[model samples]
Target: MIDFGFTLSKSSTVDLNKIDHSRYDQLVKLVPTARMCMNCGSCGATCTVSEYKGMSVRKVLYGIQRGEDVKAMLSSCMLCGKCTMVCPRGINTRNLILNLCKLYD
Candidate 1:
């Protein structure tokens, strides 16, 4: 019999002032439609991956805006274009995810 009592807890504090704004600025410049996101949750609701996993396009974008590490979430995107089709704000969700992936790469 093996008893496992080990648990890993992840915790970190983000300093907004310390985050490099230039990277985000460059990203926005590359994907101008990203700035139009209204955070309306439409993208998240329409996401196929989000239904299986907790990944949401809106959340990932917000994390990027806050300079948070969202590589894992960003990688989960399928680029199926469902989110973009449902976007009321007309944000290019697929392209945004691709750009984020490139940024992290």
Candidate 2:
């Protein structure tokens, strides 16, 4: 059977110089309010799917910012709007998720 989970070499760290910024830039344009995120954890606290492992808005956003693989986390989002309702910054969390989905497409 294929292992699919082989460990990387110690030197295989992420090359920050090779990271792509196009997708992130497009997302910023589509959802300007995303830049206002305070990493306050309100969105994650209110997420309906937060109880599930590996599904937090804050973590997903951070992954996106770093150009990491966040597709799984984004896919798990229920888009219930609860995060938006409780966001202290009044960010449109639902729309942000929708826009992020479009970006991955």
Candidate 3:
């Protein structure tokens, strides 16, 4: 057998039942528009910082749901409203981000 310099990475599977969903639930309650996101990636595509720094609203939303600390990521957002403009579902992404910030604050 040939020796490889690298090894397989650990599983990235998330156990949803084990994670706390209170934050996400509270966000949805605060901003009902958040519940309508379908992860279409349009927001990310139009996001001003996404191409330069990988900032993405979708990722923030996912991070909230997964119980991950996303304050650093959210800090990169400029609140430009470009994401909201391109969203197919008419989700107010800028407002969502604002509410997320408040939720985390």
How do the predictions measure up, each by TM-score?
0.79, 0.80, 0.85
Clashing residue pairs found in predicted model 3 = none
Using TM-score, give the best candidate's number.
Answer: 3
Q: In lDDT terms, how accurate is model 3? A: 0.85
Order of candidate numbers by lDDT, starting with the best:
3, 2, 1
Residues forming the 10-long window of minimal summed lDDT in candidate 2: 7-16
Q: Is 1 or 3 the stronger prediction by lDDT?
A: 3
lDDT of 1 by residue, 12-74 (tens): 466778676665687799889888887999888878888666677788877877777888878
Q: Which one wins on lDDT?
A: 3
Two-way lDDT contest, 1 vs 2, winner: 2
Off-target runs (Cα >4 Å) in candidate 3 are 1-9
- How many residue pairs collide in each prediction? 0, 0, 0
Q: Write one digit per residue (lDDT tens) for candidate 3, span 1-105.
A: 676987879876788887889989988888888888888889898889887668888888887888777888788889999999899988888888888888765
Deviation in Å, model 3, residue 38 alpha carbon: 1.0
